[model samples]
Target: MREVFQAELKSIGDELIQMSKLVAEAMERAYASFETADTDIAQEVIAADQRIDYLQNSLDERAIDVLALQGPVASDLRMIVGSLRMSASLERMGDLARHIAQLTRLRYPNQVAPARLVDTFKEMARLDIKIAHKVTQLLETRDLTIASEIIALNTSVDKLHASVFRAVAEAEWAESAPVTADATLTSRYFERYADHGVSVARKVNYLVTGEWDPELSAALDQD
Candidate 1:
């Protein structure tokens, strides 16, 4: 029975790893579409989100089955619960990527962001891609250090988001309201994407250590 349970846990973990990688790829392609006004890439990211959603739903069912049959205790129980929440965070990250892609689709043949802010948006996209990969690593290795690194990376995304707001608010700002709205919303989507990555890492930390990090808890509380 113990051997069977271990196998089941490994299967769920593997699925989680796969989901994170797919989301990371989606983030990459979505940004590429945004940067180059590639409608095809945007549509690919949008279409891929459905697969991530299906994985999350399937993971949830398996997790509940484990809880029902195995009656997991202590860390085993934590792993089950944490996997469910982490899957949720991953799903949300995919949604954010889809939103970015949708923005690209909506403004195809023309850039989604203003000309001046294109570089900043590019940097935001790059950071999210990095964060997504880190989450995938953390899922496999359960390295708490990566979790801290993810939080630090999220801080960078938050700073970039703030810069977008500042640029839009400046007196010298000359972009149209629609352009400004796109910039604001795009920045927001990237920031939220990073936040979900951090959230998943935190859940993994809790699953391993069996105790919540005070800092992570406080940060999540603010969210």
Candidate 2:
């Protein structure tokens, strides 16, 4: 029974890493499409979202199977349950990327944002990718030291989110200016994407160390 449980856990872990990679890539491509104003890239991002959704469902099934058959208890149980939660987070990340892609598709042949803002969006995408990479590392190391750093990184993400939203809230672009709308939506997308990455990290911390930090919620006044 224990061996089966371990195998199941390993399988779930592998899936999480793969899902993380896919979601990160989606964010990259979606934002790249926005940067280049390329409809083809946007369409690709939209289509890839379906695959990410399928992966999330499969992960959920494997997690449920583990819980039912293994009856995972204590830390093992936490790990199994957290897998489902993290899967949801990863799926949401993909959804945000898809939203960006859809925005690109809806507003083609028009500048969606200032050239300067394109750099900003790319920066946000980089942040998303970085956080995903960090979470993957945390999963393997289960190092409390690394987990503590994530809380600080989440702070940086929160600041970026606030800055982006505030900038958009104050801006005024004409209705025909798809660039402004796209910029606003892209900023929001990155914010939500970063939030999901933080969620994944928090779940990992809770599972490995039995401590759930509320850094993200606290940073956003969510609770």
User: Which candidate wins on TM-score?
Assistant: 1
RMSD of each: 1.2, 2.6
TM-score, candidate 2, is: 0.87
Candidate 2 per-residue lDDT, tens place, 15-80, comes to: 888888888788888878877778999999999999989998998998988888878788878787
State every prediction's TM-score relative to the real structure. Answer: 0.96, 0.87
lDDT of each structure? 0.90, 0.76
Off by over 4 Å in 1: 220-223
* Model 1 vs. true fold: TM: 0.96
Worst 10 residues of 2 by lDDT: 214-223
Q: Write the per-residue lDDT of candidate 1 for residues 63-173, one digit (tens) a residue.
A: 999999999998788888889989999999999999999999998888998888989999999999999999999998988999998888888888888899889888999
The candidate maximizing lDDT is: 1
